[model samples]
Target: MAGFANLSQAARTWSIGFMEFDPQNAFNNAGAVLRQLSALLVSYSLSFVGAVLLLVIGYLVAGLVERWLNAALAHIHGFDLTLRNFFSKIARYAILVLVFIMVLGQFGVQTASIIAAIGAVGLAIGLALQGTLQNIAAGVMLLVLRPFRIGEDVQVGSIRGTINEIGLFATSLHTSDGLYILAPNSSLWSQPVTNYTRNQTRSNAITVRIKPDADIDQAQRALIRLAQSDSRVLADKTPSASVSEVADDAVTLTLTYWTAVGDFGGTKNDLTKRAKLTLDQQGLSKV
Candidate 1:
């Protein structure tokens, strides 16, 4: 019985010791886990704060740089406004990309790998957007060479309108008939462009047909008088009248005059109407 009691006591003591050790080990493990979690949270919080600061400061600096560049370009003599805006925007975006890389670095991201991936993606995009890239190239050339300017009347391909805006990818035009046109920069650069507003004055040719025997001299004098009386006609360039063609039953009288470019269409219409009226008053009948 004594031996049996001693064995029971030893067993109880071992059970108690095991129970105490397990709880203490569990508490220690819990404490270790909490400590690791706190350290991880602290690391992440610092990284997040750093990233936010970088983003805010970077965006502010980018905007300031863009504005400063624009102002500086505006002061340059003969610099195109479209070019200035394009360059400023490019600068701002470049700065933003740098800031993004820095922010990623704060989070322990590998920047070299990211740059390589971006390059690969960029190559794919460039291949996919060949036409778009061409337009951008053409746009750069256009801005630098200045074939046409904003608010100028120009005709390219089948499009005719006043230039509303010029951008890196396309050109906007406002037509005389109240329509808007967006033309790709590549097409404009490749095709021939007709600029109507480049010249201060434009020549207008007005032809009137009268009866072959119906006083050619009188008809000529009447046309010349009509052109000269018009205020839109250039005073320095005197109107000239000549017999261009002599048909069987009709004589063609050509009146050439110079007028302000803006007034060319209206002046031509008015002169033709007046010429017809003048010939009727002179008893000249049309063929």
Candidate 2:
């Protein structure tokens, strides 16, 4: 009976010791877990705050830099407004991109890997949008070379209109009949472009068919007088009239004159009408 009591007491003591150890170990593990969690929260909070601050500062800095660049470009002589805006926009985006990368770094992200991935994506996108990329490239060249400017009348391909706006990928035009046209920069850059308003003076040729039996000398004189009387004609450029072609039906009289570029269309129409009237008065009938 003594031996059995001693065994029971020993078992109870072992059970109590095990219970105490288990509770102590569990408490220690919980404390350690809480400490680690607190540290993690602190680190994450700081990173979040830093990233937010960086983003705000970066945005403000970008705006300021853009404004400063625009002002500086405005002071430059002969700088195009479109180019100025484009460059300012590029600068702002570049700064913002840098700030974003820095913010990512603050969060322990691998910036180098991200940049590489971005490059790969950009390359893929470039290949997919080859035509669009070409237009952008052509637009940049157009802005630099300045083959034409806004508000100028130009003929590109089969489209003739006045340039309303020049954009990064396309150009807008307004036609004489009140139609709007959007032309890709690539098309304009690849083809021949005729700018009607580039020069100050334009040459006009008017051909009038007169009866073969009509007095040629009288007709020529009348044509020259009519051209000289027109206010739009450049007086310094003397008008000339001659027989260009002789046909079985009639003789073609050619009148060559110079006029101000702006007055070319109006002058040509008026001169043709006046020449017909003058020929009629001279008893010369057009065939």
Candidate 3:
């Protein structure tokens, strides 16, 4: 009977301690905090995944559109493939910028005000670069006109070089000294441009002075032979070598011939060197 009474008292004391501890209330608050944390983690994960997917979709869309337009415009009656590649790149980049803006917007950013501020800043920057902007405008005109293109040798603004690239605001030229010279299109547009590659073949004229005492007839024959022997020289254009000037010490003979544009510089050098050698071999003298 005493053992049963002690067990009943112990049970009553344990029940009182449980009420004071409040285990159910504690678990309820803990479970709510866990749910909030889990929701936040899921939201952050979704946002990150969404950003990545947006960027990938943007790139693929831009690429496909760029490729399609490039091909279509290249085959258009009045357009050039170079122009197609150029404009397509610009469009693609523009699209990418827009996509980037959208991604930023997804992160709860106020893009409109940001874009407005950017526009204002861009306007200030543009004002600062007025001259460069003019060059860019002129470059657009040059590309449209297509006065010259890559690999074409041209003379503009007292500078001569092979055109390596035609960018938005500047033109790159590889000079004879192996230097790349970027000439602004505003200056290029204002100046006269001479494109040597406009025609398939070009005329090369060589002027050599010989002693006045030398026979003009015999010297003419020698120079003509020198001009004619080269395989690259064309005959249909009517090659000629004649006494063009009678100076105090020498008679200048100008030999004019036609050769492929590819051989412009090489042929000129080879012809000059070989002609001098041939004249010396024949005992011809300007001395």
The TM-scores, one per candidate, come to: 0.69, 0.77, 0.60
Q: Count the backbone clashes (under 3 Å) in each candidate.
A: 0, 0, 0
Listing every candidate in turn, what is its Cα RMSD in Å to the true structure after a full C-alpha superposition?
6.6, 5.4, 10.2
For model 1 the local lDDT of residue 154 reads 94
Ranking by TM-score: 2, 1, 3
Write candidate 3's Cα lDDT for 164-228 as tens digits.
Answer: 98877899999878988988889899999999998899998988878778788887788888778
Name the better of 1 and 2 by TM-score: 2
Task: Give candidate 3 misplaced runs (Cα > 4 Å).
Answer: 1-71, 77-129
Off by over 4 Å in 2: 1-53, 77-82, 213-215
Local distance difference test, per candidate?
A: 0.92, 0.92, 0.86
Model 2, 1-287: lDDT tens per residue? 99999999999999998877877779999999999999999999999999999999999999999999999999988677888999999999999999999999999999999999989999999999999999999998888887889889999889899999888899999999999999999999999899999889999999898998888998999999999988888999999999998978798999999998889999999998888888887788574
Query: Clashing residue pairs in candidate 3, if any?
Result: none
Q: What lDDT tens digits, residue by residue, belong to model 1 across residues 1-287?
A: 99999999999999998877877779999999999999999999999999999999999999999999999999988788878988999999999999999999998999999999989999999999999999999999988888899989999989999999889999999999999899999999999899998888999998989987888888888889888999999989999999999989899999999999889889989998898888888888483
How does candidate 3 score on lDDT? 0.86
Candidate 2, which ten residues in sequence have the lowest lDDT sum? 278-287
